[model samples]
Target: MSKLEHAELVDGVREELITYLQNGTVNKQAVARTLDITELGIDEIDRLKRIHFCLSSDVVDFIETLQGRLRRIKTANQRDREITRGEVRGGIDWQATTRVRYTESAGDRTRFACKTPYTEYDIGENLVLKKLLWLVHSTVQEDISDINYDWRREAWPTERIAMFDRIYARNVHLNRIRDGEDIRVTRRMLNTARTARQSLYTDAYRLYDRYRRLLAGKYEDEDVSQLLSNTLVIPERLPRLFELFCIFQLLRCLSSRGLRLQPIESGAKQLAILESDQYTVDIYHDQNGGLSFHVPLSELEGIEADYIDRYQNVQRRHGELVDAFLGNDTQPSLFSGRPDLVLEVYESRAREVLTAVVLGEIKYSDNQQTFTRGLEELLKYIEFAQYEEYLSDLDIDIQGLIISDGVETNRDSPLDGEVTHISASDLISVGYPESWIPTQIR
Candidate 1:
């Protein structure tokens, strides 16, 4: 390995990750999970040891802006009045009945009825209420309340945690909105609040817009994983960091090929789709059960026979892998197989791979031993995929690749099968993912 290969402070790693985020739309949840793929052990030190209140700057802006505006929120009111014999308000309605019936009393006395048009500052004020509720009940707010010992908070020092507690409680309480009031957060209501034309509300809307932009993965030059992790989650280990570097490098490669990120419908895997006129590529990292394509051992008879046939065809010193020897109880037969990284490509409209399956392993070192080990792993994964159950149901072809720093590799492969291995060092010398996987468009 080169002196700089896994050096203490790896240059360009964080910068590379940040550049990728700035360039493409990614699965944020998946990104979050990947950047924090560390677990605690009884003997090993954990990453999340230094835990303090952490929120993005945008989150701070959303909380503080709302906190400042809540004090002077302008109320938009819509109200009406009616005739009453009580006190005079909003002027009396002249057309309303002026006659009043006296209550049953010892002395017969007559009272006057005054129809009044009193304005209740409800509708317009409720607009602000609707806007407030809309923002307060959003995922943004849920994210905060999720972490708060109680409620509202920010990194701001003017007023500390107690101040946040008061503000958050007050905001949720929403004293501006009365109990039993009808408050609906409709698009029209939001538009009304947004276009309220008041400086206070307009400022509130500005903060709202900023917050939304931040939520949409628009952090200028910030490494989101680091920003959120606070020196924790972003792996300090060289190998792990290299793994993330590789994944992002893959994302950039796919992004260049018109990759569109699909929102994760369920779990923490980053799933993306790359489509072309002829086919669609489904890119998944950690898949269902951590294997994008897997299969059982029983489905491998034809594939095993293929290997045996290849061994027979090729001029080799080894004898044939006869069925009796392969399946004898003297040794246990292999059962199932899966790979490390995956990019599943098929037809544009089809759900299965009609062409071929390309298997690859990512290695961070340039040393021969690491390279050879990675190749062996890749060969096994690829070779086994040819024999797996779920995949065996469909017609399949298999190829292999090993992405490494550089290797004096002898190109060990299956009987007659040759796997392509490339150096990822091209990322620095040539371009991104600079090495090519077998199935890549290029």
Candidate 2:
């Protein structure tokens, strides 16, 4: 093929990628399945490890809620501790106290062996929680060099990793649980835990059972398989993967700010909902949500009109772009070709009113033409699509941002202040403003 034909072919491929990504198919799990952990860099491996841990939502909830559930797991009256002072600390075993005295036949009268029964904690079933905590803590605290996939580490960012350190610290509930022969767990012991008759212990027992099962490498969940199975790797051949990676990086950064991943319904195509009590960011992969494609939009209330609108209805209309695309007979989503990602940011506290929107078009190409084409689409989106800040306070504004996987070219737009592009790698490390989010919550 000639250069013109080659360029056209390449452009055709880029267009198809948007459709594939937008069709509810390119989610975290799907993207994860395409990952080859061995081929990734150390930081990227750590990044995957973090996302992998989260892919198992059950596991995330289990870890976060486990300690709180350990209530019914009170100290048991365990009776087999050895006392060093000949005096019986709990009960005297004359045999134990005197046998050692007699066996040595040395004049060591100060040392006495006694049978001590203590109630501080038990090593039978009660110790299972400690053992579980120890297992997770040790795995998380391992040096990156020691990562051999024996267990996947939850390498949270610095502060959060320190937070995990505190939660996993043995001293938080009792002495640090050290691994040893004494910490051994048997099948009988696990069975005893699972069969606990008390309702109060139900959650605790269930969590412990999962902990034991997970540690044993019996991952019955497909999410866990995606995380641990070496063969279920992301090959380089997967298209538009960098787009997903860029989004994951954004999610990770938002996560560092107390935003959490909300569970999507089974078979749901939503990429994710990064939410906090104050805000909700619903991210869609390569679908028309804001303007053309499908958006899993939540019905919201409390839409007070632009408070100023009560005085004067100053209206704004997206002009030229509207003239180009809008028609009375047209039906869209109703379907238009999907944008790479449609992020609907909402003020969840205000009846989940939309506050901001991020209409994104990802181009996994260094080709100037490809980059320019994607950038033009985004600029056009800004022209026709206007998401208002409906709080009646902040002025509605429109801006654009590009997040990429290290493709460098001039992205300056002559029509506006900026259609600034950012490297995906930097997004992982830095913070961004709410204004950079073009569409606002209604």
Candidate 3:
């Protein structure tokens, strides 16, 4: 095949891989079935297989982290409730206390009372302990379900299967306790639970290590080192993962500012600003309005009106760009693009609302070509946002941030004094900018 044909083939396979990775319903088998393995050479087939394996492994790791966090949060909340209820139900006891004399009793010279009071067994502690046992059981059950459905069909090794079986049995024992079939919450049982959890972690790490070893051994021609360096392992999922990382960091920053943001419970792609039903920030992948602030419009003065009008125009243009980016009407070009993540701050108090938007492009690859392209894309986004009419009249500021795992350039590239470049680690470490984010919506 010619260079063009080979490039096309690679692109096609890559697109299919990305789609399979992104779809919630699609699995590895589906992706494998779609690819014409017979048409590809041995090397190509191996590369594709390695990519799929890495992607699946990364996704599992991501889910495991999420599950652990959710379990902890749920366990803590449940424990708290159980503790409170237990405390209320089982009042304090005066069993192990010294007697104290009170002065001036009606019939007797003095009355005696216990100096210190305490319960024989801390009911709250027992209740919380029981809840923790239950949590472990539930978490294990969840893992079992995931493994049975997601990994059972995969061609994993015998040792991996044995590891999973061990994990399953350990959980089954704890789950029985949760069901009250074998009612026990002893120190031994707690130790068993802790040991089981540690075992599970060890098994998971081993599985991931196995995949890494396989990739490293098989893909000799490719830069396997770069692949190993990827946090998510899969290149396709990097964008989504990057967005989530940014959102997580942003939430942490917002929490420090006394603002609480929680994921919307209804599975809607948005986060709720706690205590307010009217405000929310929507999340999306590789498009404008990924992190959008929806607020009511406030009344404004003459200068504010100009800002609002210009901001509206920018929004209109952004909408158009998004449509083009998502559609095949226009070919991929410098002018036609969308940011990997967009954060829009809306002000709504009276009537005439003003808005500020920050467009961020994320590059997970350390490849020089990819990094350069990311910079170019960011420059285009900034240039598109810098309208002379808007710049002069609008209070709205459009800032462009290019966040890359490795960027080639060192110099400052400014478009209307709005563009900035930073390493992905720095962005994650520093979190959302306090200076950039407004304290109040109005």
Candidate 4:
């Protein structure tokens, strides 16, 4: 493999290891073992090691605390389920009422309502509380991860650590229930655990696993896999891989999974709103009664004119060159004036592809970045759609080009048939300021 390819693989592995090891889940040793790298090389080795030690030592103690709370709920569950003469009652009861909760606190005279599943009351609040307790109990049995740690809090630096402590506590409660001891205690433990689990789900762990899994499949192709494993992977250079995956997954989740994004009921051609990682494209009607497309370059670096001057110049020149080629060899179509310029250089060809389009996506980033799974997905969609065939059938010979920031490679691809992929370096070195491409690049 070339030096660039080797660099990309190393980078990808480094980032993956960092994410897993530093994210409070795995120990440094585990990370090092997985990557087959020396543990000493990990910069935060000591810190991660300490965290692992603390978690292992305190896990049991934390579980006990959570189990105590669960025991109370379990006791209430047995009492609540006792069938009355004809009524199936399930509700919380104010087990005991005290005239005061704390003598030292302000307004200590306020009444204290110690609540549990109702044994007598049929009021809405009691019934709801009873049902809630049952629901929480069931949830604990089903998912200990749903345990609520909200009743516990700590200062900023230690907040996450404290939350983990709370999670461990709930696990203890779950263990009691699983062991079938102190049913009421288990019930209460489950209730608290349910609340904690819900809070954790909504507030934390934003399902990054989904993205990881979806992206994982994209690199399964032997070439990309080998490239990533042995090189320092730079995502920006080959954004097509990642971009296409995101689009495919986003569309799948939104359209098939019944996400909020939906088409209009009327005959309007709206499909769904798409969320993008690096950029977004919106299509709508123009002011002149013609179709218009909007491809936002927000969040893209190198947008300042001077930085992209060379890129744009090369792109324009590449366009002229392609035109000259078609003019000389391929006959021009009879319908449109200057058959649509399919590929044009915009700027930067060292490490990433940078291209501008009249009606398509134009990605801008510095340096060559390796291709990602997202790009593969996008390419697959285009291929399966038989984009070229569609264009040919319509008598429109639309050319598709990928202008990359790196050196244009002669890498073999199952996908690249009529669609051309060129590095910005190739376009500038050969095609820029000229009406013909270097035979080497083509």
Candidate of highest lDDT: 2
**TM-score of model 4 vs. true structure:** 0.21
Tens-digit per-residue lDDT, 1-442, candidate 1:
7323644224435555444445554444444545443322211111121121224454355555556566665544343544344455555544333323333222223323344443343444445543443554343333333343322234534364345546645664355455422554455654655788665555444444443444454546244344533432345345655655555566566656655544334433434555666665655544432233344233444665767555434422222344345642322234344555666666664645445455667777888888778877776665545323544355654566566766645543434455666565554443423224434454
- State every prediction's TM-score relative to the real structure: 0.55, 0.38, 0.35, 0.21
| Candidate 3 residue-wise lDDT, 24-91, digit = tens | 21233323322423223222323554444433444345333433433322122211111121123223
Q: Model 4: residues >4 Å from true position, as ranges?
A: 1-393, 403-405, 408-442
lDDT of all predictions: 0.48, 0.50, 0.40, 0.30
Per-residue lDDT for 39-67 in model 4, tens only?
A: 22333333323222222212223333433
The local lDDT score (0 to 100) that residue 143 gets in candidate 1 is 38
Worst 10 residues of 1 by lDDT: 42-51
Q: Which stretches of candidate 2 lie over 4 Å from their true place?
A: 1-229, 236-238, 293-335, 349-352, 386-399, 409-418, 428-442
lDDT of 3 at 317: 70
Candidate RMSDs in order: 11.2, 19.5, 19.6, 22.1
Q: Is candidate 3 or candidate 4 better by lDDT?
A: 3
